[model samples]
Target: MLRYYGVDLLDHHRGTLSARRVWVLLKHLPRDSAFARELHGEESAWGLGEHLLASVIDHLAIGNWLFTSAHTAEGESPPDPPVPVPRPGVADEEDETPAASAGEQDLAWFFADL
Candidate 1:
């Protein structure tokens, strides 16, 4: 998962600073530590919630790195768009603005309560 997101644990200078920091945290955190127990449970067994939380944190770090790199890249041409241009007569769903769905609202509520 870390490699998929360009985090190079073997090389200190390879990955982004934020990603490296995340790697350090995960690497140094003991399985039976108080922080781990608090985050999970007394047994420190990972459940679905723990997996999802880790994934969200990893993605957020990658996103932050991307934004910072884009702004700091001096005189570099921006990369080509990932998606192709929309056809003249065809409506692209990706171009549409979506209202918050029921699931999104529920997820927001869940996090708020946490």
Candidate 2:
């Protein structure tokens, strides 16, 4: 499951970012507290909605296992929304373009390599 399905990663990063995006997020995380924070961010956000996915991840506990103070006591507002566009991945899966013809596969063009 860890290899095939990264649920924790998915939970915190489903819409706002892909696995590659997450590496960027991980880069921005406090280096000292990255591991525990990133893991905590992922685990704590289980079952959260897709829209809120990024925020929950932004609150990662860090590698040092420290908690993020949502309210900094300085009256800071909640973080802003993520960019609307999605990153690249598996585009062909969603592609409505027609597949090659049956004969195409059987033709010299298809078998050229084989």
**Stretches of candidate 2 above 4 Å error?**
1-8, 12-16, 34-114
What tens-digit string does per-residue lDDT give for candidate 1 at 1-114? 243345444443454445446545644566555545444444345545666776677677667666766886678765542443222223467565433224334334424522
All models, RMSD in angstroms: 20.7, 20.2
Clashing residue pairs found in predicted model 1: none
**Model 1, runs deviating above 4 Å:** 1-44, 73-114
> Model 2 over residues 1-114: C-alpha lDDT tens digits?
123334356543457545555544544544234342243433322333643654445444231123234544557654444333232221344676443334323333523433
lDDT of 1 at 44: 47
Top model number, lDDT: 1
